[model samples]
Target: MPKLLVTAFDDEFCDEVVKVLGSKGIHIHGGNRVVSIDGNSQVDSVSLENGSKIQADMVLVSIGAKPASDLARQPGLRIVENGSIWVDEYMRTNAEDVFAVGDCAVKRDFFTRKAAPVWLASTATAEARNAGTNIYGIRVLHQIQGTISAFSTQIGGVAFASTGMTCRACQKEGFRYVTATAVAPDRHPGMLPGASELKVKLVFADRSGIILGGQVSGGFSAGELINMIALAIQKKVTVRELDMLQIATHPLLTSAPTVHPVINAAHQALAKLRAVGRELPPVKKAA
Candidate 1:
């Protein structure tokens, strides 16, 4: 394959993708946009706004879908400027007793409390469950206030996963944040067969130590590892708590006990927190 362009809202994740793809001899063009096509009858090459061109035999454009709010509009339901059906924390629509979920419903970010354009089946199902449980009357199942935007994907034998807010999102949303990264072998011993390198990055609120987001890239286990980080974010786990986290590690299943990437990343953030004299107590050494 020729050089390709991959765009993402998370700058760190985008760079990680570039690094992984680059190692496989795949060239990547970051932060560029296709301005025009070179061929008249077909796309022989594509020109980017940066004055670089990519030769290609095929061009695939994956544009996002907008919510079909026209029908909902006829019933006097409210719509956001982006045309998605507006809904409350419980997925309730503007009209009396009306509920909306899934891709068509507008979403907000969990920490930033800003409108989120993310769309995913998992998120939709979560919203559906919240709405379904609360339709008749409010219950103990808490109403969902915003979307965490947890997601994962794999490329070139590496699984990439992320959740909550990226550094870009934090900056754009005007949150003070700090970030740290750690690298480790995915197996107990690096010499083990199928052992792959794992990299974990975490972002936290600068003052409070609350986890803002996390990114992981590594072996197939990365798909599930990031989910655990996502759950921590949902439960409001801080960097201090993550540094003290306990987990089962096996020679065939996980990283070495001394160098787990997630805990080490939290340790990195904890060091920074201590430097600033934050109130977070240092986490006890992991066993």
Candidate 2:
């Protein structure tokens, strides 16, 4: 068993490695952003940000990547601090027709109207498809949608997932978001042998009543649960929709849909919004 030392701490990619590494029953010692290894024989101690050090048998350094923008930047195209090729709404860069995509471009989010990193395969493909179709003739999709920043991982037989912004992120971004958190036993009755504990937190914009993001911790339910939250977020679903959702649940398979953790969390957030006197607007439903 090679004692793997992980040093990748970038909020973006670190989670990917964490999810994969968790499968091997390997030990991880580092905090969210820091890892220290002292017994591995293959790789030596690796230095990183904040003067932190880790001794590892093997070191996997995952300094987040810079967008491959040298090609565009060489010709006087602008580059973001993170090295992404800057582009306009139509995916047009400073240099016309030289469209950049994948890990090489800056993508603006529709909801926040801010430029965030585009690491999602779906985002890249969507951008590429729009660019390809509009390159020659017709005008089409011109913007990327709200970046929910969804990710998930399986650790020690239990899965974890998150979407939208974390509590820290939302506060830092200054979003007027309300949150509802609920922890319950998965598979209904608490005493069932396979029943597992699940925690769900749903955050929504106070003024718009749109689901801002969600986080889930639990067993098999976590994987799909987060997806549901992500969709609600993507479609700007409101607490009302969640309250009115017709879901399928069972004693052995899931909790009653009427009081599911996800839906319950939305209800929870609504209370917070009302407590703060923020008006809850009607949330748009998906067609």
TM-score per prediction, in order, is 0.88, 0.74
Residue 59 of model 1, lDDT score: 81
Clash list (residue pairs), candidate 2: 37-55, 40-57, 41-57, 43-57
Candidate 1 local lDDT, 1-287, one digit each (tens): 12222212266557667787889998766557779878977779999988988999898787577888899999899999579899878888999999999999999888766778878998999988998888997773545758888888898877888887778768777889888999999998888999999888899999889898988887888889888988989888889898888889999989987899999999999899888888864544448
Candidate 1 TM-score over all chains jointly: 0.88
Winning candidate number (lDDT): 1
The TM-score leader among the candidates is 1
Model 1 CA deviation exceeding 4 Å by range:
1-12, 23-26, 38-41, 51-53, 281-287
lDDT of 1: 0.83
Residue 50 local lDDT, model 2: 50
Question: Model-by-model lDDT, in order?
Answer: 0.83, 0.68
Q: How many residue pairs clash in each candidate?
A: 0, 4
Error of 2 at 7 (Å): 16
